[model samples]
Target chain A: MNEQLAFTIEVFLNGLMAGVLYALVALGFVLIYKASGIFNYAQGVMALFAAMTLVGIQNGQVPFAHLINAIFGTDVHKFGWHVHSFAAILLTVIVMIALAWMVQQFVFKHLVGQEPIILFMATIGLAYFLEGVADLMWGSELKALNVCASEGNCLPQGMNVWLEGTTYEALGYGFFIDNLDIVASIVAAVLVAGLVIFAQYTKQGRAMRAVADDHQAALSVGVSLNFIWVLVWSLAGFVALVAGIMWGAKSGVQFSLSLIALKALPVLMLGGFTSIPGAIIGGLIIGVGEKLFEFLIGAPFLGGATENWFAYMLALVFLVFRPQGLFGEKIIERV
Target chain B: MLDDAKQADAQVDNVLEVNNIEVIYNHVILVLKGVSLNVPKGGITALLGGNGAGKTTTLKAISGLLASERGEVTKGSIKYRGQDIQHADPAETVKQGVVQVMEGRHCFEHLTIEENLMTGAYTRTDGNAAIAADLELVYNYFPRLKERRKSQAGYTSGGEQQMCAVGRALMSKPETILLDEPSMGLAPQLVEQIFDIVKSINEQEGVTFLLAEQNTNVALRFAHYGYILESGRVVMDGPAKDLRENQDVKEFYLGMSDEGRKSFRDVRSYRRRKRWLS
Candidate 1:
């Protein structure tokens, strides 16, 4: 009931919400890495591209409008029509799937059986390439992703009045919590649950795990490496879309949106690259740790902005103590 | 009557035929120089050789696993069921009923034993019921696998891991299995047990086996046919019985001769006396 305690609870809650967002992005990295041993440097750019495509589709903006105008000397941009948010999302998903296929077919197919470092480097090139393509398609402008705003059921933003009023009545001080954060937490929970079921129950899921364990053994058992790799890429794309939606809705879709992936790096180091549960828990730990640190010491003693580097510092500590992350599979060596 | 049936089998078309295949690694190191062999249906055929003698290369070529390692069958052809398959994908080869249980017991280390076996049936379109039935059949052959079915494969003993690898291959219901060095790194008793299972799998299931082994004594005992390889070439091949009784094989491989148990140092003068090489 103390005023400080209530505010601390509020900060802790916000940190948890932010952690959920980080885990969402980190989930994409874990999916591709676990399946192919490729770190997928383009995961952030994937989120950026997915968000950009969603906005372009929703507003019925012409793709490559700038390029078209430059070539034809005509000012043409929009189709003069609006698409439903749900339809836009569906189309975006289709586009993401197509992108996944092309990435596998054109880029990674030739790089099969290459060293992990080579694969990682290829993803870096892919990230920059995809970013340029998305920029050209959408014209590199910030777009507000209202997400069903046209339908009058837009993604809620700002503090929840109900939670604030109830907390004020009960504890003599209101707790501030964003409705968007609540939604993101719920989405993340559902996404994680769906992924776990898909991985643990399906036939293709079994093959995915088999490929992750040993590519040679999986191929010998008749599991197609190309198919599984594409499947994994598609899954990662789907995760990226979900993450992009949540983050974009919170702070209008922009190039800065992709920078959230940098935040996910520390979370992965803490959680372990190959673990799903590790990502979620690691995100939560990082979320709470950074927020609490900023509140207690960062703002007062370190003059604020400690949240920017607190997660990385904490992750570095974890890396030193547990190089495998909190839940990475231990390497087994036969002596 | 049995001898007549055996003679008829010898005349029948082979399930797998490799004709003078030359394997080059990284396009430079020639690992298999014109190696050739045949695997008859429902028989254990042993490819025998010392280390680096191209035993594993021959099996990988048959299974189409060489491509992953940058090894190419450049000079000759490999035919499975009389279809040319030198350039086929390993998964395609598996789908066509030929599977390779890779050397060194490459079990899916993180998966449970049952899950690891189930992965072998990844290409089967016969539904889970058939897969379950095959799983039970595999369990019957390797009961230890069934007991450790819930345990992570990497944690199981080496013998159990070998059994799991073989049992995993069986779950695919393969018509022909290219087994590479199943006896490697195991105790003598465990080696005998695995060989026994391979023999039974061949007899009861009527599955064809092309096994590569360094233990010439045991491979000769169980194999119906044998090909002895030396430095990327098949030096000699015959019925398993003949290879077991051949004079050079006795001195070099089985560690016995007419003079009885002479060390390699004592037999150095006879090194160039290999009649097949000569």
Candidate 2:
């Protein structure tokens, strides 16, 4: 009924929307970490690369054009053609699959049976190498990813006018909500449901979980570790692409987009790295906690911008109480 | 050196032939030094040894699981039905019908009992009906597993986990199972129950078994043939009946001498004077 209440409700709704996006990214991390125990520092970069690749393919830009032009003294960038967004997305997925295969074959295959810390260090190296390769392939420039069909069907931007007018008429105050955020929430829900079904029912999905539980045991049962790892990486890549398209559309495809992973770290800490539902719930908690804190106390008492650090602070406090995370398997002790 | 009576039993077609295999761990530590054995088809062959005597290492070598632990069969060969499988991967070995149930019951702890059994059928290309039939067969063998099928394996007791491991392996329809220390950490009664299941599985399913165990008395009882290993080498090999009657095995392994039940103090000194080792 009041302006403050309406604004608070608006913030809460926006926080849920943001949490969905965080969960999208967190899904990628959980998939890879669950299967192989690799933290996959490259996940965020994989998103950036997928988004950039999608844009490049849609624009018909030649891969490594700059390097080729510099070497051969030929000026050729694009083929002067555009690809349909749907076709470009399909091509990007294929490319992501190939990248998954190459990563497993060239990098991780030899690193099998190595320590977790060693595998983690390898992923760190892979992240930097992949980031550099993506920049070289697509050129480091801001690009707009257009997934919409046309002007009428385009991803609607700006505040929802209908919501604002309706809320104003009902409560004597307007609520702000972005149409893009609503779309993101729906997409994230569908993605999560699909993942849960696949994991719960399918043969390969069961194998993935088996591998996650015990690699040696899974192998003994005839589960191919290499195939499972590649499958997991490809799934992670697909999730990353979905996340990439969402974030890239929100703010043009840029280097800073990868920093979204830094935000997801606190989410993982809160959710536990081994859980999917924990990720979603943790993301929601972090998102709402930060937004509410910024609104109530951050602006009025503390200097504004507590939103930047609030999630981490909350996650740190949460870790003190529940280190295994909300949904993590409890470590059982036997005397 | 085979005796006349036991030599005739060795004529059965060997399902698995592990010949003079030397396993090296981390490329330096020699674990299995030219260990050799033969597992007759449809019989339970036991590898009996003490701690660190390379029983588990030999099983891992045959099952192609040693590579995962940074242990490699660096010398000799392992043949399953005349096919060389020393370098085959673990998955390939499983496909070839050789599955190793690792020691300490390495069940997928997070998975439910049924889900863990299903994972054993991962490599099978047959339809779900076949897998379901096998699931029922496994449950019949391990009804306790069926009762706790929905419970997570981590919460299961030690004996139950051991049974779950064997049942899970059985779901793979394996020809030969390399069971490593199934008796470890189980009560004596539970160990007897597990050995009974292994005997029944061997008789009913016609599956070959190369079980590595430290309980020489029980292992000798269930096994048709037995090999004794000391410091990674096969010290003695014979039919289980003859092995049970061997004077050296009785004194050293079964912990009984012709004189009487030897005390641990005298046995410790007598172990150093092993005639077989000399």
Estimate the TM-score for candidate 2.
0.95
| lDDT score for residue B217 of model 1 | 98
Instruction: For candidate 1, give the lDDT of residue A289.
Output: 91
Instruction: Label model 1 with its docking quality class.
Output: medium
Summarize candidate 1's per-residue lDDT along A112-183 as a digit string, tens digits: 778999999999999999999999999887889877433443335433333223233446777777766787
What DockQ do the predictions score, one after another? Answer: 0.71, 0.72
Off by over 4 Å in 1: A149-170, A332-335, B1-8, B261-278
Local error of candidate 1 at residue A55 (angstroms): 1.0
Which one wins on TM-score?
1
Model 2: CA > 4 A from native: A149-170, A332-335, B1-12, B261-270, B273-278
TM-score of chain A of each: 0.94, 0.93
